[model samples]
Target: MGRVTTEPSAYHRRMAEQKRSAIIDAATGLFLDSGYDGTSLARIAEAAGVSRATLFKQFPTKAALFDAIVTEYWKVEGEGGLDLRPGDLRAGLTAVGRRYVALLTRPRMVALFRIVIAEAPRFPELGQTQFKRGKMPYFTSVRRYLEAEHEAGTVRLDDPELATTQFLGMIADYVFWPRMLLVDWSPDEASMARAVDEAVLTIEARYATSSARPA
Candidate 1:
């Protein structure tokens, strides 16, 4: 049998993806350990086992790499895996709340927020980019869900967008802020469950239509 030859283009593409993933993995760890300003491209290149030229070829700037990290971590499904049970508003909200909490309280996410806040003053665009790309999509998804529930008469909200923001704020207040600010703060499963339960209750009390209530 004749020897088979691999296509040069295919091999290069596969190698490129591997190198990109390695850089992202290394950068994520270093960025979390050392804040944005503290970490450098050279350090990331070393950690990723690639040369400086390779790192720059993949990500031309630090901001580009940081944005990539945010996109990777913050990209969640539009519905956030909410189960839209027709009359079970509480259950749906609880599911969404739990997922939201998981996303917000992840260690890498918390670290990224800290980095953005710390470096935003110097690079204002970073904050804007994070808000537009990382945060807005989740907000929009929640708003769309609330709007759908409102149209279905399952919830009664004058402004679905505002209600969505408030619901997210409630969850963030209980889960995200503490984790972000306190170096050693870690909530047990029971505490997290309680928080999500409380959040769901709060949202339902505020917005659920009388008809949506379980008989």
Candidate 2:
């Protein structure tokens, strides 16, 4: 039998990915605890058990690391996995609203929001990048779902984009904002259900066709 040898490049690539994951995990905790202005690459490297040179090789800057952390959070949090189903528009929208509220109101996500808000003035690009990468994709997906519903006669909206925005805003104002602004304020299941129900009802009343509405 011929001798087999593993490729050095493949081994290096796997190690790099493992290191990146570790770095992101450490950075997420540090960023959540200390906020963006308070976290440094040295601290993250030490916490991640990597050298500063290795951390720099992966992220290059604090903002870049923050961006990676936000992206990783969303990926693990299932923000990219929301999909509009074929039946029961109201149920689908309600589920989406509830999940979105849950994600935004979670402690870690609220901490991320605080970090972004606090550091946005100093690192404006961080805010922009978070919106472009983290927030906009979900919003765009919702808008597209609404548009499909409208075209399918499931909803009757003059503007699907505006209607989608309004639907999200309803939940955000009712559930997310309070939790974000008040550390002591956490919505119980009843409150979350009520908010999501109201948001679904409002959207259905305004946009869903009579046949598409829940009985």
Candidate 3:
């Protein structure tokens, strides 16, 4: 009978985490260089200086690895604590709008969106997972601010989810679907800035109540 290895110690666990982070970074570089479909597990393992077996031990499948990369790449701390006070609805929405614009304009973020959209048909749940962990958190963060405004009688949103979706849709429209679909022209800084400004103005116009209007 084969002898089973004992569980890793706390120190070993930390070291393992470091290795996994390194592997993910290496995989990200490869994914960006060769695209997800072009990149292979062996290539990632070689790049990470790990054996194929070790890579599998860390991430069972390509989809699993991609999902981890997606979540980690977009992950932001303190997003759950977005300030939702009752004053300056336009300013508050603009802050959130700019953050979204920044995210969409990032090179890595654009690449990630392309990868996910291309692979989404094969992996239906991929979109759902990304939406749940990535987009949902962002929406929830902004929704908290919206809810506060509603409670304070500054905004009049009966359905916070609908409001959140509408606000995000405005930002999405600025990305230009043809460019996303064809990997054509990237948004310049000036264009992105204008888009963010317009999105904030639109959302505020739709949702702001008397008290929340900018003074």
Candidate 4:
């Protein structure tokens, strides 16, 4: 029985998570196709094949759902912590840079950003929500990672925030931000990998201490 059986609560929780994913997927598509204001929670529930009661139970307001979208878009929940441990500046940054590149280049991520930019004048809350709920937490992890490296003497920085901005800015300026302005801009995987390498090298050049330099 233990081997083949599922606890009712575990099953229920799995089912609940699935429903949430469905709701988010449905809501994202609707938000993309119809715009946030043009879409409604009830419509999202219908598109998701869940009841209005269920959708409201998970997200009471459209803003709440949109916030959820931003959170999910960044995979921000379990990703609150950095993968680095305060050594190997080039290696740590290269890993982080690659992950950042992947996130920035995701199709859904671009759409999520587009929605915020497209609707910013009308629904300023969406932009604020994305910045606070989506951007800050992710950046905080990177900042903390940089701070840890600074403390360990792996990297020397007068201002970590500035360095963090500079490092991530390099990657985004190449691989990510162009998509926002140039409608057809899409760099291939090799280009993205090159961007990551270049950012890592730039940071290593400016920030990594002599001892921290790899052999």
Top model by lDDT, which number?
Answer: 4
Q: Over the stretch 1-215, how does candidate 4's per-residue lDDT look in tens digits?
A: 45765556877999999999999999988998999999999999999999999999999999989998888877632353466787778878888888788778766788888889888999999999999988777788898999999999988889989998988899999998888888889889998999889988988889889998878
- Model 2 lDDT tens row, 1-215: 99787766887989988999899878878877887778899999999999999999889998788788677655524544776664578877977887777667654777677777877898898789789877787788788878778778898878878998898999888777776667788768898889888988988888888889767
Q: Estimate each model's TM-score.
A: 0.83, 0.82, 0.75, 0.90
lDDT per residue for candidate 3 within 97-151, as digits (tens), equals 7777665665466666666676678766767767776677777878888888788
Which is better, 1 or 3, measured by TM-score? 1
- lDDT, candidate 1, 122-155, per-residue tens: 8887798789888887788677778878888899
Error of 2 at 110 (Å): 0.9
lDDT for each of the candidates?
0.81, 0.80, 0.76, 0.87
**Candidate closer to the true structure by TM-score (higher is better), 1 or 4:** 4
**Model 3 error, position 52 (Å):** 4.2
lDDT ranking of the models: 4, 1, 2, 3
Among the numbered candidates, top TM-score falls to 4
Residue pairs that clash (backbone atoms under 3 angstroms), model 4: none
> Where does candidate 2 stray beyond 4 Å?
1-22, 32-38, 76-80
Q: How do these models rank on TM-score, best leading?
A: 4, 1, 2, 3
Candidate 4 error regions (>4 Å): 1-8, 76-80
TM-score of 3: 0.75
